[model samples]
Target: MLTSESRRRDFPTLDGRAYLNTAAEGVPPLAVGEALAQYFRDKQLGMDGRVPHAAQWEAARALTAEFLGLTAAEIGICSCSSEAYNLAALALQLQPGDEVICTDLDFPASSTPWLQPACPATLRLWKHRSGALHVEDLIPLLSPRTRLVNVSLVSFYNGFTVALPPIVEAVRKHSPALLGVDVTQAIGRIPLDLRGADLIVSSTHKWILASHGGGLVGVPKDRAKEWTAPAGGWFNLEDAFGPGSFEAVKSKPGAASFMVGMPNYPALYAVRAGLEYLRGVGVANIDAHARPLVLHCLTELRKLPVEVLTPDEPDHIAGILAFKHPKAAEINARLHAGNVHVMNPTGRLRVAVHGYNTHDDIERLLRELKAALAAV
Candidate 1:
């Protein structure tokens, strides 16, 4: 088991202020930063031309695959989750009048691609009453023409963790729809079994502790061949640099076909280091240590005048705790003024606790929050 003190050493930013905003962007560990800096220095020294770029990119892909419990061939390196969503939308073969079901609470990245006016697709929006979309509510929205059901594994604002297995089963049973997930919030903070999802998209910046501009897309093994590559670049070809390779050969199979261009190598190298760090700490153990801090925040916040929005059940919660006080903006301003940081999603305050956070940090946050409220 990794100790909190040792984990805290990994994040140098923890020395300055309380960082309770992993949901917005995680603090990359010193190792990842050093790896990225080394890559930058190597490039500056003109060693990038001598390095085996393909081998390094392939290794990065393999590391990401192992982290998500998928085959390397099933994972595609993307610039962001939004790009991954666009790839999934193009590959789904949606016909005219086909319906794409998504929730109102979904981040715009997951919904906007399907809403393109020229796409010849219909949008079915699921309503959220309490910042959550239950499976029962989704079932009523499903129709025979529904071709896809897209949702986030954990909501960005409220941190309501969806029960994905049952939702996948429900979608599969109700319609011949492809089930897609935006797992940006859930990837490193929670344990995910990717078998149930037909398509999964995530960014490495949050929770994974990677540099920005790196993302991942996971496609199911059985349905891999059904996806057609609409956006093609050199990296998507089997022999990208081979003689006459530009003659437009058949698209490579699986998630590799989704690759459009040369990936951000330095960002990927940093992501690889972050994945190695996550492996050393054990994602399950990280969740075990982090979840308690989230629960502690919830428990303590409930005692105050704040309205706790994140669910109390551990099974249905991620590392985020969201709440709203009557003077939420004022309280958040006060907290920030005191050198304590939290996320303000629109109006609600989101507190994301990660492995680097200690119980003392949570206590300090609670103290500051109470003081902020009193001042307000």
Candidate 2:
């Protein structure tokens, strides 16, 4: 089983602090740094490093495919989650009278693309009730006019893990809409059965413990034929040609069609290292390790005055635990002063735990949080 003691050495950033902010930005492992260094070293080598870098990119894509339980052909690497979402939005090619449903709790990147003037679709929000989104609420919003339904597999704001299987079943029954899921918050932190989603996207830097500048997009084989590539370049084309010889071109099959330009090689290399590390530890084991900690945090927080936004049920929660407090920003600064890291966005505080986090880390956060709350 994966344990904090076994994984702590890989994350040197935890040496003098309790890092409970994987939700905001993950701290990369030592191996990821070494991977980036090696990328530069390899770049300085034979043939201007083109062959080696291309191979590394392909390897990274393959590793990402394994991580997401999708085939390599179904995966495309891009700059970030927003770009992935944009690609998905463009591919849908919504027409007038088409409606797309997004949750009110969604990060703007997931829904804003559908609201652009160029997109002819009407954007509808599946509103959350009392800090929670229910599948039943989403069901009524779905209809024949719905062309796409975008949702985050896990709520970035509150750590609520939306029950996707029910969402999938509901969408299949109520609408012809394709399901697009933002796995940015859930990826690398939980076990994902991605078969239900037609398209999925994530950034590499969060719970994956990688660097920024790279993102993942996947389209399962069964759904790949339904969309067209919005843009194309030599990397995505079936036939390569120089500027003078340019003509109409066709994209390669599946998600590879989304790779419109050169990839972020350095970030992709680090992503490969991060994905490799997670597979080595096993994601299921990581989930098990986190469950008790989440329960403990939830149980303890109930004794405090703050409103727990994350559900107490393990089925509805993941690595993050969020709470509402008017003094959240102040408390976040206090925790930072005490060398305990967490995220405070406006009125809520979010603390995230991962494979490298220990019970001691949670206790440290609790102690510091109590002090900070009292001081506030």
lDDT values for all models: 0.81, 0.85
How do all models score by TM-score? 0.93, 0.96
Q: How good is model 1 by TM-score?
A: 0.93
Per residue, candidate 2 scores C-alpha lDDT tens digits across 86-172 of 777767777899999999878889999987889898999999887788889999999999998989988888888898889999999
Off by over 4 Å in 2: 1-5, 46-48, 242-245
Report the C-alpha lDDT of model 1 over 1-376, residue by residue, as the tens digit.
2475775678766775888998998988888988787677667757563274455577778888887788888888878888888877778768897999998868889999888877788999977766677788888888789988988888887888888778888898888888888889887777788667888888889988998888788876786876656666777767777777667565666687778787788878878888888878888998988888888788898899888887666777888889987788888899888778898768899999888877877988999999988888
Worst 10 residues of 2 by lDDT: 1-10
What RMSD, rounded to one decimal, does every model reach?
Answer: 2.1, 1.7
Q: Name the regions of candidate 1 deviating beyond 4 angstroms.
A: 1-4, 44-52, 239-249
Residue 127: error of model 2 in Å?
1.1
